[model samples]
Target: MLTEELLTLAAAAGAAVATAAGTDAWEGLRARLGHWFGRGDGRRGEAALAELDGSAAELLEGGTPTGGELERCGAAWRDRVVATLERLDGPDRDEAAHDLRRLLAEEPTAPKIHSGDQHVQGDIRVHAEQGSLAAALINGNVHFSPPPPPVRPEG
Candidate 1:
């Protein structure tokens, strides 16, 4: 059983993880999350990173953006975070909760973007820089395609 504070921390971590997916904040969050759960273990960090990636992919193509799947994933992660916190005792748990709070504090300000239901008689280009392109439909039709990978600058 988690205390109310721990429960809130777990929920915040879960929601922040979900919200940060596909955004610029994701990589930083991922690394910090990996370190948090991994505790300086490389293998554990990689595994945690993979899980985060999988969650983002699933949420993107779940056919119900911002729907039940989101809640389900959030709950799943909340459980996982709570379980991790449970393993720690006293000062360590407090430290873990503080780390979680730090991570959640980095969440970017997400904007509500709704396409369609408006006049789109011209070209519509939605450049959602450093944010999630969620719940945006094309021509008022549902398109379940994942956004393309970000282009990297060549050095």
Candidate 2:
């Protein structure tokens, strides 16, 4: 049995993988995870890559996923991580857990929004580096106005 800390780490890795799918960081995260899971085996590495691709495809299917879908996908990956950790012995398990922590730490937390060709008919809230803000309702077209010029300071 794995320690609580290690189990938590595995859970976080799984969540991170689920969150990284279809985002800008997806490719890099996917490659690193594949290599980690592969553990120097070429066939295993290829299989891992295939599995990751399938996860991404499932999450990206249709469009925005429902909350249940996200939870299910995350749990699936978490189980995979836990199983992998269970197979390792002593130091190997610790090292794998450490690697997972590193991967999670390096992952970008910023959410990426891809509108693609979908049309939005309701209000949307956008969260970015600048901060969260409310978006106006959309009928069909979208427009953006430049920020007003900064006020000059009195000399």
State TM-scores per candidate.
0.64, 0.69
- lDDT tens string, model 1, 1-155? 66766775676667556655656776777778888888678998789889987887777664435535555666677788999999989998888877776665554522121222232221123324367663535566543544333222122
The best candidate in terms of lDDT: 2
Model 2, 145: alpha-carbon shift in Å? 25
List where candidate 1 sits over 4 angstroms from the true fold: 62-64, 109-155
Q: What is the lDDT of residue 112 in candidate 2?
A: 24
Write out the backbone clash pairs for model 2: none
User: Candidate 1 versus the native: TM-score?
Assistant: 0.64
lDDT for 55 in candidate 2 is: 84
Q: Determine the backbone clash count of candidate 2.
A: 0
Cα shift from native, residue 132, model 1 (Å): 33
